[model samples]
Target: MSADCLFCKIVAGEIPADVVHETGATLAFRDIGPKAPVHVLVIPKAHHADVAALAVTDPALAGEVLAAAAEVARKEGLLAHGYRTIFNTGGYGGQEVFHVHAHVVGGAPLGPMLSPR
Candidate 1:
């Protein structure tokens, strides 16, 4: 984990978050600054840093994170219609938080994607 990453701090309990779920290897929480009504995030507890960094040797760990995200989506009632999951890697994709996270968003109709503010 990077020394100054915001999410690493949260995972370390050095900061606070509206955590929704936590397991042996991951944590799920409500996104403080949400993009959609039901937005939430699933992150690896061990701190892998970024999606671009995932590798074949890490497949099992990576699968755990994805499964945890799906579990959170189902629990949040976002499945009957559908949900959108995204990982914004690095700066170009708008990853303000450096710690890798999967965004789980959807419930009601999203209407339209907002233009970047």
Candidate 2:
């Protein structure tokens, strides 16, 4: 675990987060800044720079992250209407935290995937 990484601290219990779900390999928590009615962040217990890094270095753990996100959606009652899972890759991708994480957002209509350019 990267000592300076925020998500790693969260995983290590050094920092506090509103965790929603957890597994042997993953942790799901509520986003501090919620963009939708439900916005949760799912991350692997292990540290990885970003989604691409995680996918390349440990695909199985990446799958566990996705599975945890799905479980969060189900428990949040978003399965009927559907939910969105996002992985912001880097600076250009709007990833503020370096640690790999999946943003599971739903509970209302998210008008567009991105702003119209």
Model 2 ranges with Cα > 4 A deviation: none
Q: Per-residue lDDT for 1 in model 1?
A: 64
lDDT (Cα, tens digit) per residue for candidate 2, span 9-117 = 9999999999999999999999999999999999999999899999899999988898899899999999999989999998999999999999999999998899988
Model 1, span 25-98: residue lDDT tens: 88999998887888999998876767766534477778888999999988998889889888888888888777
Model 2 per-residue lDDT at 45: 92
Output the worst ten-in-a-row residue range by lDDT, candidate 2: 61-70
Q: Quote each prediction's TM-score.
A: 0.87, 0.98
Model 1 residue runs over 4 Å out of place are 111-117
Clashing pairs in 2: none
Specify the highest-lDDT model's number. 2
What pairs collide in candidate 1? none
